[model samples]
Target: MSMPGKRVQGGKQARGRAGLCQALLSLLLFTLLLLCVPVRAEPVLTMGYVEFPPFFFTDARGQAQGTIIEMARKVTQRAGYQLNPVYFPPRRMEKSLAEGRIDLWIGLDTFELMAHNTLSSKTVVSTIELRAYHKPGKPPISHLDQLAGSQVGVYFGYSYGGWMKRIQDPASGIEPVFVRIRSQAARMLTSDRIDYLLDYRGPFESQVDSNITGYLEYETLATYNLYFVLSRKRPDTYQLMSQLENAWRQLKREGEI
Candidate 1:
């Protein structure tokens, strides 16, 4: 005959200890669950875009959309980053890019452009052919010699290769009229304000205005190998470039680029 209440008291003490152990084990599991969950940091990149047809532009809803914009989205997503697109005027694009105010830009033909703080990706994203437009019945531009003393309409900040140097020279006799937009250049050509308007093939050929298309004849001038660039003053610049190259190559393989 043991003490009458001793067994009951022992049983209660054991139950209480088990309950405390269970509580501690549950807390440990909760702590482990918290550790297992990843806390993702949002990496952000600012890309500079200009309004040029078939590339990237702001739509009526004030949102950026286009083939180029879509590609940007894909590249950034693949890189585990978020994008903040900043639109710049053609003339201001390179300046912004060079100063690191924008981390990336696309369609750069001249590799040295924005050379100060910019590094181009090792991938060639696109090969673009530049074309010249003149009013119908105007003589074809077979060579640069034909442009002497003729007024050629060009967009501001556009690079026309060696011809640009000649145009800039006062003695070259090639009168270059700079316009802010391609449409303006086309309109100038249609109105005989200029003898020629040069731009990429796709945009010129797809002109929505009949008058501009009906009056223009085209000739291929140059082909440019364009690349995307990363600003040196940005964070994770090389990493972003690597991601961009991989994503771009994958997209190209899938026919999405």
Candidate 2:
């Protein structure tokens, strides 16, 4: 009877040990799972873009919408980043990019832009033509010199084939009336506020029947390929750039870029 009683007590002790061991094993597995789980935080990329109608512009709903906007959305989203678009004058955009306030800039290449610590994507996104438009009944501006001393309506943050900087110089004798948006260029020209308005040729002619009209004509000055410039000094710039390159390559294969 004593031996049987001892065996029973041992059995209970063994069972308790087994139960404790099982509970410990479960706890270990739970801890392992917690360690293995990945933390996913989608990084937000602040992108700087100027107003270029038919390509980049604000819709009536006050949302930025255009071809460039669509492309940006796809590339950034696929790269695991959310895009935050910011509008600024071309000069200020460059400054903001250099200062690390803007993470990306979408524009044509130039020595000035290249001087910044940025990485240009391997793909050429698109081409834009710098064209000058004039109102009806006026002689067509066949040459740039024709309006040496006249006021030319221009957007604040766009590169007019480097002509913006040259003409903006005091010695150039050409007056530049910088407008906040692209829509105002056509209106200012028709209203005689500016002698000629500089705009992208393709966008200016894209209008089926725009709100502003007066037998407008334009002359193309120069065509430039636009590129996506990533900041070298900004945080997570390299990772974002790598993602951009990957997205751009895939897009090229699909003929989307």
Candidate 3:
């Protein structure tokens, strides 16, 4: 038979081993709990825009409000994202978007010369016909070539299709003048400084002050579609684009677009 002191010593040793095993099991359980838990998501996204009235503009509340804004909110909501829309002048907005400071922008037309690395959604909106705005008494321009010898004002950094490129060529004979902003161009048109202003129909109608409308006349030239542009610099760009496209389609099907 074992001595009593040896039996006592054996009992203490067993207890010590059992205590170590219990401690290790507790540590393993705690680690497993940590691994199984889900992490919280971050809320962050930047959207860029230029001040185009009726489509997008800052209201009295200092919030971006317009049809496009509504559409964007719906799409982003579906993706569990929020938009931090930044309003910049047209040229600066384009530059910021190219530099990766902004995640996405609306009202960007699909053009070959523009920053094409961006992923563009199928045309979500369509622009009314392009028009020439002039003082009440001026002759209308029926053909593109008729624009020659006329001082035409266009928004700076805005693409008016291949027409701008052609106009830029010295041999094209069209004298195109680029204004800093749409409001400035409207003012110039009203004052009869420029012979003509090339603009889309909706903005020309909605934004020009009612008092000035009597002095100006717009004639439709051509129509085009507008697209939502997504930055390629952002991760999961393809997935994001897909989500947005689906969301927009759903909205359209529901007659919300």
lDDT by residue (18-37, candidate 3, tens digit) is 99999999999999999899
Q: Residues 1-257, candidate 1, lDDT per residue (tens digit)? A: 68868998999999999999999999999999999999897687788887766777888988887777888888787767787887888658777787788888887636345656788877887767787788788888866667778898876766665367767787877888888766677778878999987778766655447766775788887787768888888877787788889888887788876
- lDDT, model 1, position 83: 78
Off by over 4 Å in 3: 1-43, 111-115, 181-184
C-alpha displacement of 129 in model 2, angstroms? 2.0
Native-referenced Cα lDDT, model 2:
0.77
Worst 10 residues of 2 by lDDT: 205-214
TM-scores, in order shown?
0.78, 0.70, 0.74
Alpha carbon lDDT at 48, candidate 1: 85
Q: What is the TM-score of candidate 1?
A: 0.78
Give per-residue lDDT, candidate 1, residue 74.
84
Cα lDDT listed for each candidate: 0.77, 0.77, 0.77
Best by TM-score: 1
- Ten-residue region with minimum lDDT total, candidate 1: 108-117
RMSD of each: 5.8, 6.6, 9.3
Better of 1 and 2 by TM-score: 1
